[model samples]
Target: MPTSSPIPANEFERVLDLIELDLDYTAQHESFEDLVKLAARVAGTEISLLNLIDSFTQWTISRHGMDMEQMPREDTVCQFTIMESDFLEVKNLMLDERFREKSYVAGDAALRYYFGVPLKTPNGYSIGALCMLDRVEHTLTPEKVELLKIIADEIVARLIMVQAINNLKYDLNEAKEVKKRVAHDIRGPIGGIIGLAQLISQRGEKNKLDDVLQFIKLIQKSGTSLLELADEILNTDVKSIQAAPELTEHELNLLVFKDKLEKLYLPQAKNKSISFLVNINPENGVVPFPKNKLLQITGNLISNAMKFTPVNGKVTVDLDLELKDNAKNLHIVVRDTGVGLDVPKMEAILNGTAASTDGTSGEQGYGFGLPLVKHLVDGLNGTLTVQSALGQGAIFDIKLPFN
Candidate 1:
């Protein structure tokens, strides 16, 4: 009895690295089609394949004289080909103990000849194979074997280039997200200064010297905070930006939180001629939670609401502190009157698969806001739900437990 190749110790890591390549399953395979065809023509074989063997499936990335896309790894002769240091060649698969009972050999296809070279990565992982096959037995000359090996190297080089391109694209996206996050984070303090300036102007002659001095102090404080936040966000590394924010407990003062929220969004609403309301129940007290993450979640929600809401529309953010089952729970509701969401869009937002789209005022949204909110909520052991229909507006509800 012939035994199958032993499973590689780094199988899981190999699969993860393969996924990191972000291999395009659509038109990318066409790039390898020519290579496979060339292999078949050189070896005088009827079939040729560029195969990538992962843990569960043997993906035929490119094929000639065959219509297969993928199949179970357990049922693939190329699986053994990947395990070989040089190459595996069976002039007659029917006479080979290891491959004789395979479906392609004993069954309808009746493939006899096989010659394959392992597709090895730079990191020394044998991920797949480039193989040529035929119905009748045939021998591959030394020159043809060397030619096949050279073709396999070309294929591996192409794969490496694809992976590098994908990695560059991913890094670019991450950088964009970092900029969006910084813009979102700085809004509160910057808006505080603008709102405070407006307040000072409104108080004109009636403003006391003491009040004016206090406002100036507030402006200075907000400016300092904004500078700090800008520095931190701008200096964040790509790896840090890609990672989820840690859930760390801190004291959350509800009144201060509400005031900050008002300062952040009220002026924008006023400029847009929209109604913005911040209502907080039991707006005083300190609770333990991840303050920054909660702010991120709520800020994203409210900013999105205001962005989509039209002039004269209403956008309200309500924060309710409730005691249920001897535990403290915070409920946040952001309701907006705007062009609403369809089922597919809503599902996509929650699933983090939504694409960036233009807002009502032609404002470009990051498309990642709601998804990041969902992620933050989940990280904090919270529940988030949404209800909306097209032309009916949207309501986002979030509930977080504070023990």
Candidate 2:
């Protein structure tokens, strides 16, 4: 029997969870078809179906002696099956007022008998049903009913396995993306290390020992950053690819970040005869945020800006703190005076769909930089916006909240 309420209390959430499984609604699998066939045989019925019910549609994933694949929810007896915590058996559909008006009952199919058991999820939501149907009234013995219950449980188990497989596939894809991101992110730090090493080599006789030691310290920091990022992405023990790194409170030193950025891009800027500037509000000497993630975000943005800006152009980075709702928020703006982005490219970059484009210096790319920046910003519960025209310039504006 159906419950008094027309819809289940958790109907919306249950349906959404079902949809996320990404099941194939059609009855195409041989195993599913066999189970439905066995179900019909055990009940001595002419028809059977494995049906998943959403809010408005009953999707038949498997069937026996039927050509149909789906029906309106109002036309499905399985709708009542899902509503029930257990089996729903209407021995004579024509005699039940609730089902008498259904098209399958009153129309050409003329279905009269139905015996269904809810296919329960691990969380106890009845997402669908496995049922046997007939054109004439039929009865099930106690022993046959017990067999049907076992088969229904089997169907539920297989559905769960399907969901697990789907999730594993998604995880594997995420892992691949993480690898690409790691490779893309490590490039900047590695480049900094190489450049700093060259500077030390060139200044061996001319530079003071203290200056050489400073460059060595910079090289060590760059190498440490490179290693940290690689470890974070490669270490799957914490499921880091799926989880954002924990945010820190007043741990990010703005001064160190500013120094690192200048050390990284100053060489490149000078090589191209460009003016590069980094500005951090003195009031925000330290802020609450994940230092590594912030570095990754800003580093990627600066790298992109430097790559696209033509020789002799100017690139400026501004960082400030804002007080909103008594919480500290960080604002980052990276502005470049070079070849800017058009509408389509900007759209694609922001949406993570853009492919790699060559910079003014013909520097190649894997098209991962901006997309990775967008991802990191989103994981921080931050917002990123871009303003640009084809030839004028581009500005990337980011806002990140602090706990």
- lDDT of candidates 1 onward, in order: 0.75, 0.75
Q: lDDT value for candidate 1?
A: 0.75
User: Candidate 2 residues 1-403, lDDT tens each?
Assistant: 3322256677655664564454544323575877888999999999989888754446677888877666545456787788787699998988898888767888998999999999887777888899999998887999999899899999988887766775676556556657667667888998999999888788779988899889889999998888888777666433222322322221355665677678645766786678999999877555433343675577668778877899989999998877554366888999999899999988997897777776787654435568767876887799999999989889999999864
Off by over 4 Å in 2: 1-5, 9-31, 183-225, 231-403
RMSD of each candidate? 20.1, 21.5
Q: How far is candidate 1 from the true structure (C-alpha RMSD, Å)?
A: 20.1
The collision pairs in model 1 are none
Minimum summed lDDT over a 10-residue window in model 2 is located at: 241-250
**Model 1, C-alpha of 78: deviation from truth (Å):** 2.1
Model 1, position 380: C-alpha lDDT score: 73
CA lDDT of 84 in candidate 1? 82
Indicate the residue-level lDDT of 16 in model 2.
47
* Model 1 regions more than 4 Å off: 1-28, 139-141, 191-215, 231-403
Estimate the TM-score of every prediction.
0.50, 0.47
